[model samples]
Target: MTNRGRRIGRVGGGLPGIDRLFAALLARIDRGLAAGSIEVTLPGGGQRRLGGRAPGPGAVVDLRSWRALYRLATGGSAGWYEAWAAGEWASPDPVALFELFVANRHSLGDTARARFWSRLGRRLAHLARRNNPQKARENIAYHYDLGNDFYATWLDASMTYSSAMFEPGDTLEMGQAAKLAAILKRTNTQPAERILEIGCGWGSFAMLASGRGRRVHGVTLSAEQKRHVDAMALPGVDVTLTDYRALDGRYDAVVSIEMVEAVGREYWPAYLATIARVLKPGGRAAIQFIAFDPALFEAYARNVDFIQTYVFPGGLLIHEPEFRTIAERHGLRWEERYGFGPDYAETLRQWRERFDAADAEGRLPVDLDDGFRDLWRYYLMYCEGGFRGGGIDVVQVTLVKEG
Candidate 1:
């Protein structure tokens, strides 16, 4: 019967009240913000204040269900994210909230406890979700195969699924086009070279590269993506629905856009070897991916969160140095590294806004159902939060095989 616990209506512990949970959660949050505000409204409509900071430029959160508080209390960030997706909570300023979270990410308590049971629990969750080839395909189909028509409602004209380069004075369409051009330029798609693109989404970059005076073969596991690519029926662009390891023939250049994240850590050696093995002598390869910083890579890699549970299963982001080291071991020298993290944050913002607007207006080409929509919402925003908080970075790396 601690005084603080009793004050929070936690007498004898039937189930922790909102006050006790809120107070505990706020203690963690207090370490992160530089005097910010989060005015919380409990499930039964009672209100509580976490900080003394006022509300004009702050965030308001409504815990619509008891599950929200319970999960967030027990699960930390992963749990909070689940509650958000489950519609257990609402925030007026999600981006700002994300910023605050990220600003203190280094201090936040997402880390699994040092105890054996806690570490074991995390490892088990990760082990269960590791992306083997079959599991990889399942995960790919889970997110990418969600209907081309569904994505058509919000994606830019290019229909590029990866992050776009949002340059100054550029529209979303222009940003996507610029990203494609940047990839092609990095790979030096000139002199009628034969090119291989791993994980081509909707053939946006592949089709564009084909017209760049190069023969492009795009490989993907998503039937929907292959169908969209095939429907274009463009010459010099050969699109196939198959795994990258199954593909044949060497190429003068290779380009992959943010596809490595889905490759899974267990397949990193094979993935790097594939690109290194297939490239002609002196060929250049452009591989873009989202990566965790080296210092935080091990910690981040150890856990599976909301993204792993509902979105990209078997998806893992490696460290930058890990990419360079692995590629170098496979006989590829890293020549350039391009950071597009901010651009990715912006790109996600645009996609989410479009999706939100379309859902509001009932203008979606097809019904996504509420759960699916919320899943996408969490996926996009979570990644955006990762980028904004400097927890991750987006990169297009250039590697060269020695002649």
Candidate 2:
């Protein structure tokens, strides 16, 4: 027997009552899934089908051990990931399963969420990783400072990390260019007017804006990113290693692409306030962000997910309505919002393909292990599935500072 199989035997040996509990839990999942379906092959050659009530994605899973379900029940998404890493479960296409779960999140309710004690523990752990200035820099380094070469292996030539705005027949590079153009247009700044880019990733927007005869100042917390940007030496652009809160100069426009998500929910007000403070009166700030459905925000905030646990330590998806309210409070008028969730899904799909190809060709960083690669691949698929499910969305909005 494999280690997972041996462990399953031990768990099954002295746990008749717990086995019944696991059965009940599986039944709850079946009842909760209002859309799509899952074909499950259990240990000991048992088979069970779940969901199938409505038309949606179909998935298949092989439960290597009942401990998988137990971990899921107690640890939520993070626990489920651990179970997968431990080989306690196997799925032919885990992305479809993620999509099914997110698509039916409303009906599924808390069926997939962490229990009280687990939720409390995870929440506390997340809070400890909060984005105070020092911690914020650490969090940024944890993901972005993985070396520019590491990202260049998989990302498009521009090294844009956020979701690209795709059009029919557009390559990843073209889509990213489109996104940058759209954001720059939203700024509506004259050639001579100054622009500020917060969390500039490798200076894509800065180079684009500078090429157009606009002076651009880009700020970032990641030293690696700053070094990369500095090396470019774009004549009309300057890159600084600085926090948004420490920004001093006033600009005619500000553009932040998918950066607000890094500013913890607690710091959202400050983020908006900084935008309002730095923008010249009547100037616009273009922001691209990912937001979770308002109805599900409360529950999501209560439990730490896989992304928060492993990928981006201090990250939180925006709750749009509340975020809009906060922007208004900071005297920034939220306007001209555009959502392209399907585009983000496509972007993720293409990125995953490129990442897989890089891995297959032995082009990824040599220092990174198989485990890290697997974690990253899983993260990409999980995000792609979330976008496909439609509960989470990517949006661009212009926030004009009130004069």
Candidate 3:
């Protein structure tokens, strides 16, 4: 038996009346399943295949303890996922297991009541984690200050952490470069103009822009990132550990990549206003960000899933209609927009593959504990699933200040 299989023999949690509970759970699963198959191996040696799709394969999940069932029945998707992460159940094919849940939406708590409460909970969660200026700094530090070495394991040499523009057979590095070039082109940046990047990460784009002999100012809250940019010592690039809210002076062009999500919904007006306040007349701006469709935005906000809790504390996604509303409110005219969800999904796949390989070779996890690694894997895969499932998208928008 495999280690996971052996685990089933020693774990506990069966009461005299538990057999009824197990039977009912199995019966409900059997009823709910329509396509795809799930083979459940209960503790102490009884196996049951509950459902199957005619030509597709299924997953084999070995429950090491009765806890997995309780969590699934009571806690919903979060509980079920946490149970897997906790080792209460073992599935050699995790993606297949997730697919089974996807096939049977009820298994992940897709009831109307669940949906209602989920939206309420997500709104509350976002408010609780809202980014006031000080909280914003703390939140940025929490995710970005994990040391340059950690991100270096998964990100490309450019250290660009946002979604990339990709083509078939394109490498992650090439896609990142493409994203940068696309943003610069959309803004119509010129070497004689002044450029301001509101969330310059590690100065990758800033350095690239400065190489064209333009004066580039890249500001961010991440001190470690500032250090990296400073080390580059690019004469025309000014990288600072400063907040965009504190910035002053006019620029010929502006750009921010995937940073608005962290600005919080309540502060979006201020952020957009700041862009308007600092840009010269007729100046152009380009921003790349994660966006959602408003139809599902409310439903999505209600869930406030694992990503919000552990990865980006103050982040909140915005949809396109909402983005246009706020931009128009602040007098920023939207010129063009492009969606890059599939590209982001592909970028994440590459990162996860590289991370797994590096860790397997003992190149990563230098000081990170086992739980941290698990959290990162979950984060990466969860975001990848979100993009692949079409729950979210990344967009690059060209805006003009009535120029």
Candidate 4:
């Protein structure tokens, strides 16, 4: 093991005594897992099985050291990731492990969540990265500004970043095109109508809508995405580096794809107000959003997860009931909601395959190193598992402004 691995293994200090504590922690986790199972290989060549009461996805995990449990007990998902990065544990299929955990989250309760001090520290850190105007730009840039070339290597030609609406026998590109068409249809706008796209990613929707003779305007915080969109220069399509709150001018219809998740729970009202404010009376807004199960939202919100920690700093999954209530408060009627969690799982799977291919074929950007690739891979797997377990979902909804 490397020096870092050795250090992680020594996290709780005293070896023989710590082993008993870690074993007790494992016992608690085993009792909580009502569905699915994990076969854990212990550090001292012993094997233990957890959660076989009900049949579900099964996983095999090799605990290389007791520190892996310590990290999981205190750090929650983020600490588990640290242990993985430091070689404290290994899994033949990490996705299954993640799926199992998410599937049994209710039964597990706080078994795998961050402890008091860790939760407080992470919550404070997340608060510091709140999505105010200035901080919002920084947060968006943190993820979306990772070079357009890097995303291009793995994303479909449309360059759409949100969940794709998949059909039978559809490729990723076909699914993405279908998603764009569905969102556009929800707008119910006629040709020559003006359309506004919030968080426009690479101008995919703008290009698609403008091709049909509609004037489309896109707003984004990522300079890289804006540059890419501007370079396209599709006729009737215009893009600017603008925050959603700063957007002005009324449009016939509005569309925001999976952008609300980054707004944070505190800013949800502001996001809906923007949508309601910009849409012409009787205009419809099509929004694609990812939401967490209501049962898990409180726990998820209390502590930062792996995605919030490493990928998107201030990100929060929507609590559907609360968000819908906010939309109603803004005089926006939320209607025609459609959810396809399995499709998102498939989408992530395809993206991971493409990313792996890009890495293997030397198509990824030269600046990205091994650690980044690993992190990206884990992100994809984690999201895929979350969707597969049905704890997280992707949905498209139409909100009609009160006329």
Candidate 3 residue lDDT tens string, 1-403: 5322223333244566666665666567766566667787787676767666343337788987787776666545555666778898887756556545544544423421133454466557657667888889989998999998888888999899998898888889999989998988877867778899999988878877887777888999999899889999987888887777888999999999998988977788888988998988888889999986566576555565556766888887887787788988888999888988989878988898988887788878578987888778767776775676565789899889985
Q: Write the per-residue lDDT of candidate 2 for residues 217-307, one digit (tens) a residue.
A: 9999999999999999997888888999888779999999999999989999989989999999999999999999999999998889989
Q: lDDT of each model, Cα atoms only? A: 0.76, 0.90, 0.76, 0.90
Candidate 2 pairs with clashing backbones: none
lDDT of 4 by residue, 1-403 (tens): 5211222232335666775677568778888888888887778665677878889989999989778888999999999999999999999989999999889888888888899999899989999999999999999999999999999999998898888889999999999999999999999999999999999998889988988888999999999999999999899888888888887789999999999888999999888999999999999999999999998789889999888999999999999999999999999999999999999999999999999999999999999999999999999999999998888999999999997
User: TM-score for every candidate vs. truth?
Assistant: 0.88, 0.96, 0.83, 0.95
Angstrom error of the Cα, residue 171, model 2: value is 1.1
Off by over 4 Å in 4: 1-17
**What global local distance difference test value does model 1 have?**
0.76
Task: Decide which is better by TM-score, 2 or 4.
Answer: 2
**Where's the lowest-lDDT run of ten residues in candidate 2?**
2-11
Tell me the tens digit of each residue's lDDT in model 1 across 255-314: 999888888877888888899899998899998898886775676676565676567777
What TM-score would you give candidate 4 relative to the actual structure?
Answer: 0.95
How far does residue 185 in candidate 3 sit from its true spot (Å)? 0.5
- Indicate whether candidate 3 or candidate 4 has the larger TM-score: 4
Lowest lDDT block of 10, candidate 3: 2-11
Pick the winner on TM-score between candidates 1 and 4.
4
Q: After superposition, how far is residue 91 of candidate 4 from its true place, in Å?
A: 1.1
Candidate 3 residues lying further than 4 Å off, grouped into runs, are 1-66, 69-78, 93-128
